[model samples]
Target: MPDSISVHFASPAEMLFTDPQGRKLGKDPVHNVEYNEISGGVYYQESIGNPFPESSSQNDESKNIWIPEPVSGQYDIQVIGTGSGDYALDILTYDQTGNSKDITQTGNILSDITQEFELNYSVVSAEQTKLQRIVNIDIKPGSDPNSINCKNRKEVISVA
Candidate 1:
């Protein structure tokens, strides 16, 4: 993995909701991290329909929420719909090594809003950089793509 973890989603039909516009990611209330847009911090990007105004590792319809130094606890991911359509939600995590895996969800939104996901992530108390802290929390259980981070793949049990 790298040094950032993100929760993001996207839909193709303009957007899910008209008033709220797109998704809003509410971080763990216990963690209370500040939200910033210019500098690197916890910030939410509301989508402006497909064919995004900018280029990214993500597709045109996607919007991302970054947690470069993810705080421990529960995270609430919500999708607000303008009407109704399908959407993809993902938890993009980086391992201590240079590998990544996305925990993804694809579903339909048939109401004003949908709060259908919860991530209860706990992590290691490493005495290192914020970057190292990110690596500590991205725990990938069993054999999966993220296991690329483990030196002894079979011995790697999830502590976080």
Candidate 2:
């Protein structure tokens, strides 16, 4: 059987609190943005934003991508980023004791950031582990004001 997990687009401001009377108050927690096509608008005041995908400079040190509390089992990790300029993908694993391991493929991938790209990966096994990886994408443009930063991003859906 394949276990499934969903990564939703939600705001950081969701939490539940109750008074001594145990009355539920405040707005209902929202996990996804509501869009109204008839009104040609987004209905909610709060919007779910994508995480900023970044790359290290040539001379600067690289940072480890961290996905804390990865459940033990098989997982399909889908990393998506702006496919506009340059990009690289790397996968790493860390055990419960914080020992790190790298599992990145050594060659160019079919998914490149010069356009839009999505890459699927698998986590076959783990020992009290976490996945620390990153899909680093960079966008650079010259002269044309119309050329701007590419910013769409998505992540993995796991099957246990």
Candidate 3:
């Protein structure tokens, strides 16, 4: 006779609601919302809006928001938006070795509606890196592609 052992893992997503300065905004008592930390990503009760300045003139430089990459291995990143206007999201990933990858997704949302999209990234030797990398996410209005704006209810999920 052979004996077998089973192992189970609980991977709840971690919700993050903060500004660029790492201020805790989602945990406010007024909102009264809590998020669960999953294995690969987070399950936020609400979405995160873009925090970049809108470009006024052609000579103005584009604004970009930077966020540290969560995991080290390959993952499927997802983003969701809810609004009436159409917006574009630009994602840029940078590794410790100075390698970078870029991804862009468009969301044409209507009034009182929602839209979602996903991007996939694979790292060959993720184990080699001891620390997580950084990823810059830029959101802008579709009409003014070069300018930046805040996206309402932007949800991000990472599944390894």
Candidate 4:
């Protein structure tokens, strides 16, 4: 059995949060975002906003990635923004029932924002027969011009 699974991001845009000036303003400079994981009765919390430093040159450092003990059933993955900018986040997890669910909110969020992305996988044991499951997430462009910062942005997820 696997104790914990690793979540990987292919690009910085999928992980990091940037400012209007394109300068990194978060503690996790490389990924530029904050994350919190709730699993196995443990409540792991991390602040996810750019408490803008007094000076533009000042940097507040923090962790961008989280790895928690794997739970057998559904779990929640939460993402929070640090500043007023465009954000694209990718989250992966397993669901015992293997059902698909999607939740999306697109708009010009003046203040801090929080979004949830869900991943589901069937429950299979070592002694049981091996099977393959496919999960797909499709992101399309919205009509709102002011809230359309993620245009032409593409991200892919593959589970085996």
lDDT of 4 by residue, 50-82 (tens): 476664643322233333344343333333444
Candidate 3 residues lying further than 4 Å off, grouped into runs, are 1-65, 73-82, 123-160
Q: Write the per-residue lDDT of candidate 3 for residues 4-97, one digit (tens) a residue.
A: 1111111112112332222321122223454323322232232334355484422212223333443344232222222234444455555544
Count clashing pairs, candidate 3: 12
Task: List candidate 1 segments past 4 Å from native.
Answer: 12-60, 95-99, 125-160
Q: Local distance difference test, per candidate?
A: 0.44, 0.29, 0.32, 0.32
After superposing candidate 4, which stretches have Cα over 4 Å from the reference?
1-3, 7-55, 60-69, 88-110, 121-160
Model 3, residue 10: C-alpha shift (Å)? 34
Per-candidate TM equals 0.46, 0.26, 0.34, 0.31
TM-score-superior candidate, 1 or 2? 1
Q: For model 2, how does the per-residue alpha-carbon lDDT over 1-160 read when each residue is reduced to its tens digit? A: 1311112212122212121223222222242322222111112233323354364422212222233343344342332221222333344554444454444432222222111122222234323333333445343434333333323333322222
TM-score of model 1 relative to the true fold? 0.46
Which numbered prediction scores highest in lDDT against the true structure? 1
Candidate 1 per-residue C-alpha lDDT over 27-63 given as tens digits, one digit per residue, 9 for 90 to 100: 3222343334222435455745436547563433455
User: Which pairs clash (backbone N, Cα, C closer than 3 Å) in model 1?
Assistant: 1-94, 1-95, 1-99, 16-81, 16-82, 17-81, 17-82
Question: What is the model-wide C-alpha lDDT for candidate 1?
Answer: 0.44
